[model samples]
Target chain A: MEVAYLGPIGSFSYRAVKLAFPDAKLTPVATLVDVIEAYEEGRVDLALVPIENSIEGPVNLTIDQLFHQSSAHVVAEIVLPIVQNLLVVDAKRAPEKIFSHPQALAQTREYLSEHFPQASSVPVASTALAAEIVQQHPTLAYAAVANLDAADFYGLVPLAKGIQDVAQNNTRFWVLGEKQPHIALPSTAQKVTLALTLPENLPGALHKAISTFAWRGIDMTKIESRPLKTVLGQYFFIIDLVSNDNIKYACKEMESLGITVRNLGKYCIYEGEK
Target chain B: MEVAYLGPIGSFSYRAVKLAFPDAKLTPVATLVDVIEAYEEGRVDLALVPIENSIEGPVNLTIDQLFHQSSAHVVAEIVLPIVQNLLVVDAKRAPEKIFSHPQALAQTREYLSEHFPQASSVPVASTALAAEIVQQHPTLAYAAVANLDAADFYGLVPLAKGIQDVAQNNTRFWVLGEKQPHIALPSTAQKVTLALTLPENLPGALHKAISTFAWRGIDMTKIESRPLKTVLGQYFFIIDLVSNDNIKYACKEMESLGITVRNLGKYCIYEGEK
Candidate 1:
């Protein structure tokens, strides 16, 4: 199957797709939208996008895109450990500036602050692209925070390895496709994803709507609220719940409480451990 | 009063500071950390940082920095309308490449996709920096998405205006200070902010935590989860509730239910009219 990912080849998303499908035909797209568009146009069977990172939190654009384009289904998820390295043009270059993707740069701010306090940190579109820039401007006295694979791909040398502040830095990627997976159910599997909106600007309106899930003993794994572009103070909640029982009853109860609940899909457990 | 913002004069954060306190002494810092550091160092009475945007959602670094520092309190908030413009060297320059801050670039993606479909988009450290790059390399045919002020500062002309797809786009900026304002009584404040964490990975842990506020008729204004950075499964929730009641009781109840609750600070209610 053809799998799409965001990249210039050496991105974490590219590595994630390779890890998940191993030998799948991989197409690297420039933006997350490109991946979604490719999947929508049937250019690829599945696409991987980074949803959240342990250090940087949720990638808001990815979440918004998921909500905006309701056609795709999150078929699988993968957590990739992120290791940011300071790649330089050459060992001889005395780097006065560092470049990296915005997220990566933010993730390694503490390290950059503590170590290279004098160097100016620049944000780039992508880490691989930063490496490419360093390769093109070999005498520019610049370094980039990127993966070792990217450094190797762009013929750059490592200035420093594992520069991220946190050793436990990891990012969770969602695999989106046209159809949900058809895996045999496991007894331990118990989760549901739902997107819903509350009634109006009434006091405690959202609380009342979400109460149904709580009262029914359903555990919320994730609950994110995005402003409904149409009206002020209105939002749509993308919720993930853990419950072996069917969510139909709770969802109905929520709707009865003036919540417009939309069942995106029900799938096997998240299997977060994997 | 002196107000510090993360920037170099024409940065988005600087514009936010200007929007909030027009006559205040605006100190431009190199980084967001510097903004916070200036506040901590008593160099600035107030600091403005972009917290969230309509197009980009929350700025994770700002949130994490706030959480990590914890010394400052969010005294006030402002939502500024963001209008990004494409500034180029000249019409004859017919820029084949574009540069912008990652967030600005992301916000203008749809516009850029439609207008400059084939041009490569690069992310610069900041909008002002992008403008500066265009100024220094006028013959390189590079355009930047920045504010009108930034374009003027760099002697560039607008190639396109209001390039963001969302017309009513706005970014929420928080004014953080060393001490919380002593507002004698909570006004008809419809929103309260709190930071808390779940007890454990139990089946209905979050459900129980959220039920306390919901069952008590508290409307949730916002709910965002961030990884605590302590453990794999642990997460911290930054929530805004609608209530003028004593939040201490809610905090106590949440703690009683084995949840860890921290009262960050509460200010006047957000009108949501903006």
Candidate 2:
């Protein structure tokens, strides 16, 4: 199957896709929107996009795009441990300029400030692009903050490993496909994600919506709010629940309360090596 | 009093600060972090930062910074009606490149794609800076998506107004001060924001936390989750509640459940003209 992912190749998303779909034909797309669009337009059978980071929280662009466009269902989850390494062409030289995706730069902010106090941190499109840029500019004292795969792919040396501020940094990626995976049988699926729209002008609307899961003794892994974009205060809540029989009932209860419930996915987690 | 805000003089934060604290001495900082740091260091009495937008949900940088570094309280909220106008140096020719901050570009994505599909969208630091750049390169067919104030400040003519995808585009700014505003009294405050950290390894921990509000009949205006940065699954929930006497009791109940609660602010909302 052909798969689309945000890449210049050797990105964290690339690593995730490679781990999850090892034999798939990988098509490197420039942006997150393009990845989803490729799948929606049937350019690829599936697409991989980073949905959340342990350090950076939700990937807003991915979530926003999913909310606004695309009818694709998440078929799989890939949890990859993120290690932001300092890569360079010459290890002995102190870099005067550092390049990275803004998220990586933020993750390594403390480390960068402590080590490369004088270096200017430039925000590029992606970590892989940062690696490519640093590799292309060998004459300049430029370093890149990227993953091991990026360093390997771009032939850059890892000047320092795990330069991120936190040791437990991990990113969760979603595999989006037009067709729901047959593996989503209740016996196999471990998680269920739903987008909930609460009825308007109702007092305690969100509270009542959460009550459906709470009273049913269901365990929710996450509940996040995104703007509905129609008004200032209205929102759409994206919820994740531990897969259980009660999820079906809870969704029904939510719908009974006039909350529009859209089942985004019921998927199993695939953890990549640390 | 002096105020620090993210700016190049005509940014949205600048406009928010100008509207909120009309006579204050304004210091334009380079980034959101700098705006907060300036206030924390006593260089400025207060700082104005964009916390949320109607179209773009929360401002991650501002929210993350507030959760991690600042001890400052949100003294007040300023809701400003955002109008993304297409500013041009010369309107006779079609633009080859369009410039705006990424958020603005995203807000105007549909509009841009429908109108200027041939033009490349360039992500700049801020919409005001985009306006300035377009003004500086007057000979080129360049357009900027920015506010009317920026166009006025940069002397660019408005090619189009309200080019955002949605008609109800509004941004909420927070005024952060080291000391709590005397106006925070229950009698005057309309909202209270709290950052809650749920106890570890507890089933339905989030639900139990929300129960504090549900049982007490309190109304919540917003609920958003941010990663605690320690692990992949752990999170910190930021909640906004309608100001009421029961807020104190709710905090006690949350603490009783072993949840760490930090009161970000109890303040009033100020709405800017549409």
RMSD of 2: 4.0
lDDT per residue (tens digit) for residues B1-274 in model 1: 7888877767767666665566777888766667777888888898877778522224766777778665677776665668899998896656788988766877899899888888988766568888988899977889999988888788999988889877766677777875543322223343457777776755566666677776666667788777777787567888887655756677788888778777656655322223
Put down candidate 1 lDDT per residue, A86-193, tens digits, no spaces: 999777756788888666877788888788888997766678878888888876889989888788788988988988877776677777875664322222344567
Using Cα atoms, each model's DockQ against the true complex is: 0.43, 0.39
lDDT tens per residue, model 2, A1-274: 8889977688888888777777778899755677889989988988989887522223766887898787889888878778889999999999999988666787798899998899998765468778998999998999999988898899999999999886776688888986644322123237989999888866678888888888888877777887787765788989888888998998888888788999998888877775
Best by DockQ, which number? 1
Ten consecutive residues with minimal summed lDDT in candidate 2 chain A? Answer: A180-189
Off by over 4 Å in 1: A54-58, A89-96, A112-120, A138-141, A179-191, A201-205, A265-274, B54-58, B89-95, B113-120, B139-141, B179-190, B201-205, B246-248, B255-258, B269-274
Model 2 — TM-score against the truth? 0.87
